[model samples]
Target: MDDIRLLPATGLEGLIAQLRSRGYRVMGPTLRDDAIVTGEIRSASDLPQGVGDEQDPARYRLRKRDDGAYFGFAAPAQSSKPVFFPAEEVIWRGRRDTAVTPDSAASASTPDNAGNPTTAPASSPHDPGFTVERDQLDAPPIALLGVRSCDLRAVQIHDKVLAGRTYIDAHYVTRREATFVVAVACSDPAATCFCASMGTGPRPAATDPATGEPSYDLLLTEIAPSDPDRHHFVLEIGTEAGRDVAHAIDTAPAEFDDQHEALAVTAHAASQQTRRITAATVRDDLRASAESSRWEDVASRCLSCTNCTLVCPTCFCTTVEDVSDLTGATAERHRVWDSCFSEDFTYIHGGPTRESVKARYRQWITHKLSSWEDQFGMLGCVGCGRCIAWCPAGIDITEEAAALGRMRAGGVLPTGDHVPTGDHVTVTS
Candidate 1:
C-alpha cells in the first residue's frame, strides 16, 4: 500500500544518494543561463534553491523566494521531453561495400600502384553492395527529480502516442520503461498556467490507470514553515522502488497535520489560477472553424519560428535526414524533431499543400486539439503554458480557443470572398 512520510530539508541529499546508489542517472532542475532547466544532478545542492520564476505571455524571469524552497517554481523553461524523446538521434547506419566471394579472394588479386600483387579485400564501396544496420540505443537508466504535474501528464500523453500505439517507437519505449519519476506538487502556478482547467494538475496523482504504471515513484509536497521545526517535505511512496528509497532516507511517518498542510499547498495553487479553458466543445468548434477568419488574424502575428512546439512536451512530430560520406561509402540516417508550423510539413507533389501561413497555423491547432483526440483518445495539449511563455508573438492557445467560442456563440461566420481552393489551404481537420 502507498504510504506518506515527512522528510526534513537535510534528507533531500539522502534521497538523491539512494537513487544514485541504485545506478540511476539522476536528472533534476538546475539554474542554467538564467533558466531552471533539467540536467544531470550529482547532489541536492545542484537544485535551484531559493529561486522561483515569474511567467506570463512571452515573458519569463527568475526571482529569489523568501521561502528558501528548492522547488518553488511552477514549471521550468524546458520539460523532460529531451530526456525520452531527444531532439536528434541516429536511427540507422548504411554502408556500400565491395563484395568479394571466397573463391575470388583466393584466386584473384589486384595489383597495387607499386605493381605488387595484393589479395582483394573482402569489402570495398566499389563492389556495389549496400547494407543498413539499426543503431543500438545505449542509455543508462534515469531518475527524474522535481517534475511538475503538467509535465508528468505530458509524459503520459507521449507514452500513449509513441509507445502504447499500434506502431511503437522502440527507442522511446526503452527509455520510458527504464525511468523512475520523482514528481513535486505545484505550489507556484504561473499566470499562463491552466492545468487546473485541463484536469491535469496543481496537485499530482501517483498512478496512471491507462498504462498500469506508477506515474511517479516518489511524490514530494513542500510545506511552508509553520514553526521552527515544521518546515519539511511530505513524501508519498507510490511504488515499491519508492519504498526502498524512503527506507534509505531519514523520514518519519507523516503527522495528520503535515499531510493536511501538503493538501492546502496544492489547493492554494489551484485557487490562485485565474486562467481556464472550456475544452469540451473545442474539438468540434475547431473542426467547423475551418473557414474562421481568426486563423488569419493569429497568423499575422505568428512568426512560425516553432518555439512553441520545441518547448511543448507532447508535440512529437519528427523528420528524418540521410547523410553520406564524401566518397559515398558510408551513410547515416537521423531522426530529428519537427513542427507542423513549417510550410514543408504538408508538402505534396506540387510544392507545399499549406502554402499560406494561416493554413499552417490552423492545421497545427486543429490537429493538436481536435484530430489528436480522434487519433490517440486524448487531447494533445496538457496545458503546461510553455507555448504561451515561449512564443515570441505571445499567442495564447486558451485565448484563441475563447475567441473561437465567442465567434460560435455570436453565430458569426467568415465571408466567402476569401474562400481557399487548390492546394493552398489545409482541408483536413
Candidate 2:
C-alpha cells in the first residue's frame, strides 16, 4: 500500500550523502562518553556500530552487540527535542536604557507619534522596541537518521503543544518545517520502555488512526542478524520530500521476503516487553486517585532533582530570564527549560505554592498523565522511558500509574485535600 525500497546496508553512506546533497545536516546516534548520544553525522561510520544499550530505572550502560548493526539500540538519552526545541535559546536582545534626544522624546510622546519620519514610533529606525531583535540561531535544516519509534512519537506530541492552535512557538515551527525525520523501527527496547502499551511504537509507521499521518517522513526497518553477509534496510516513503531523498539513493524495489518478515519479528519483541503501562481509563482514573497515598510514597523516594522532566522529550515548561552585564547597558532575554518538580516553579511572591516535595510531585505526575489529555487532546508521555531511566529516585511512572489503578479499583482514594500520610500505599500493590 506504500512505496517501498531496499537500500543495501553498504550503501548507507550514499544515503547520507544523498540527504546532505539536498541541504540536510544529519544527526544520528553515536558512542560518546561510554553512552550512546546524538551527534552530527556525515556517514554510516559515524553511527554507533556493534553497540547496544541496557537501560533500567535510574541506570543505563552501553555494550557491544554480536552484530554490527547501526540502529541495534534504544534511543539515546537526548532525543530530537534538543535538535528542534533547544535547551537554551536567546529569544531577543534588549537594552535597559538608550541615549534619548529631543527627536526621540517627541516620537515617544504618543502611541502614534504623528511625526513626518514615520506614523508609528516603534516602526521608526531608532525605536527602543526595535532594539530587541530576534537572535538568528541559524540551525541548519536537519535530517534525523536513526530516530526510534517512541522518540518520533514524542516529536508528534510536541507538535500539538508547540505548533497547535491557541499559541505557536515560532522557533519550534521554523526547525520543524525544515527538518526531515527518518525514523527507525525499534528492535531493542529498554526495560523501562512501554511505548507499545502507550500505543506509540516499536515500529515507526507512516500512518496512524488518530493523527491520520506518519510521525516521520520516512520509516525504516532494518533486516539483519539472519543474513550474515547481507544487511538490508527497507524504507517506506511518507512524504513527497521523503520520496525526493529516496530517489537520490541507490534503491531497488523491496521484495517481500523472509528477511523482511524477520525484521517484523525482531521489532515485535519490543512490543512484547514485560513492563507495561495500562492505557485504558488511565486518564480518568489517575485524576480520581490524586489523593492516594502512593503520591506520598513516591515523593519519599523522589529527590526533586528534576532529572525526569529534563530528560522527558515532551515536557516544554520554560522560563524567561532577563540577563544583564555589570554596567547594565546591555541585556538579553534567555528562554530556558524549567521543571515543575522544582519548588520555585510554582513560587508566588510570598513563598513557594508547593512547600513540600509531595505536592510538587503530585502536580507533575497528574498534569502529565491525567490532565494533559484535556489540555492538549493527547497524552503527554510517549512511553520512551526517559523519565524512568533518568530518575535518580528510580520512580517508575508506569508503576505509579498501576498503583493508582489498583487504588481506584479497590476504593477511590479519598478525593479531598492531599494529606501527607501514606497509609493507602500499603494496600495498593
Model 2, TM vs. native:
0.87
Q: Estimate each model's TM-score.
A: 0.88, 0.87
* Candidate 1: residue pairs that collide: 98-124
Error of 1 at 178 (Å): 2.5
Q: Who wins the TM-score comparison?
A: 1
lDDT of 1 by residue, 1-429 (tens): 238998898788988998898999998899999999999989999999889899888999999887668898988999988888899988999987654445544554567798676765645334467899988877789999999999999999999999998999888998877788889999999988888878789877667746767888889998763333667789988888888888788988877777888899999998878776777988887877888877877887899988999999899999999998887778899999999889878788989988888888888888878888899887888788889899998888887777766666767766443323221321112
Q: How close is candidate 1 to the true structure, as a TM-score?
A: 0.88
Error of 2 at 254 (Å): 1.5
Ten-residue stretch with the least lDDT total in model 1: 420-429
Which residue pairs clash in candidate 2?
A: none
lDDT of 2 by residue, 82-114 (tens): 888988888999764554445655666343556
Q: What is the C-alpha RMSD of each candidate to the true structure, in Å?
A: 7.8, 5.9
Can you tell me which runs of candidate 1 are displaced by over 4 Å? Answer: 99-127, 225-228, 415-429
